[model samples]
Target: MRFIRYVLRALNPKTAVTMDSRQVFRIRRCVVAGVIAVLVIAMVSCGVYGVKMHAQRAAQASQSATSTDKTTAKRQNSKKESSGKQSQKSQDNADTEDSVQAELKNQSASLTDDQRNEILAKAQQTARDNGHEPTQYTYCVAQKGDVGSLDDFANAVYRILNGERGWSRAGATFVQGADGNCDFNIVLSEARYMTTFSPDCSTEYSCRVDENVIINDDRWNGGTNDWLSAGGDMARYRVMVINHEVGHRLGHTDNETTCAGAGQLAPLMQEQSMHLDGCATNEYPLDGELWIK
Candidate 1:
């Protein structure tokens, strides 16, 4: 009010003559309304800016959280894959260990000391009687845990090899020992374990694998039907078995030669134990039949 009165006093009477109380009141009210509208617009602009900034911060926070979640998931997946691979490798190693243990157990169950000694004694005696000079070939003799008398079997093998018309005629002499440094191995195996040494022959027949001659206990104990038909002699069958397996060690393969005549001697390389095929039983190799070079 004071500022208005001062303004009216400063003006001349003629200039202020039209001013009324109501008009002055109306002007004051208009001025107050304009100031309030300006203040309201400024407040509204500040509120809009605040809302925009808050929204931007919220969006940025959401994006960062999403990125963090993806990184964490990838790390977890990598860890799981690595763990899975390690687990599989461990399993494979465990399986290998088990297999080795089983094989060792099987080998450990083989021939006892007493049996080996008996076999050694017999082999020595037989070698004294039948072993010839020049020492052409040496063989290692081994027996399965359940097979009988390695010495007796070794002696039999020696006798056959040094017989009148045996491998000795071909200038090849065989000696028996347990040492690994032998030219060939003659293993007396039980029927149950034959396939372990001779996978090709399985259990049906004796076989030669590498330089190892595997002999089946079943055939040794009981002569085959062909041998029985000829003479029912266990001795002749033993001779045949030794010669056949040793023939394989001497670079001979399975020979399907049938007997030439009903009474002729079967070829030493023939599968005589299975079938004579109309041949007489002949344990010793015929003259010039050594075929060893």
Candidate 2:
């Protein structure tokens, strides 16, 4: 009330008028209420703005965290995929190796030392009994990749060449080993390795490529149908193969001759492996005409 009276006095100092005290008091109350209302509104606006800004920051932080998690997951997934591919490649390589080993095991054959020694002994004895001048040859039995025993093959070749009814009758002889000058090389090779000697010859047949008497491993293991049909004698076929190839080495050409008679022996120069026709199988040079003059 005193403050209102002072304000009123300052405003109307010159005019000394009679005013109601209640009206002055009502004016002062209205002014005070207006001021208080403005202050409350300012404080509420500041608090609302602050809360909005804090919410925005929190939302932004949450979005950033979500993006970071996604990036980490992508990286982890990529690593797992790369590791899986490498593991598959390693497994594939291991499988391929195992397959190769199995194939080799199936194709290979084994030969013993005792069997080789016996074959060598028999071949040497046969050479001595054939009554021919000693001719020298280098005999080597080879295989491509672990196919069979070299010793047994070498002995078989020696036995074939030194047989009583074979080249011995032609006065040609063979000395074992490469120490002496070799007239020719008798190579007993596996079927897979036959191409090394005679590139044009098939594994089903024997050939004389240059000075090499290339005998096929397949034919050595299995006899020809013609010989089997006649007597089922593998020995006879073995003898025939030896004579045929050796004949080529001794300047005998492919005769392609048939049997003169139905019961006669087939010519030694004939391709008996193909067919015997009506003739019996012959392993030797008949009529004493094959001798070296």
If scored against the real structure, what TM-score would every candidate get? 0.52, 0.50
Question: Residue 267, candidate 1: how far off, in angstroms?
Answer: 0.7
lDDT of 2 by residue, 131-169 (tens): 555454454444454546665555555566656566665
Model 2, TM vs. native: 0.50
Number of residue pairs clashing in candidate 1, backbone atoms closer than 3 angstroms, sequence gap of 3 or more or interchain: 1
Give me the runs in candidate 1 sitting further than 4 Å from their true place.
Answer: 1-135
Give the range where candidate 1 is weakest over 10 consecutive residues by summed lDDT.
126-135
Q: Model 1, 276: alpha-carbon shift in Å?
A: 0.7
The 10 consecutive residues of candidate 2 with the worst lDDT sum are: 102-111
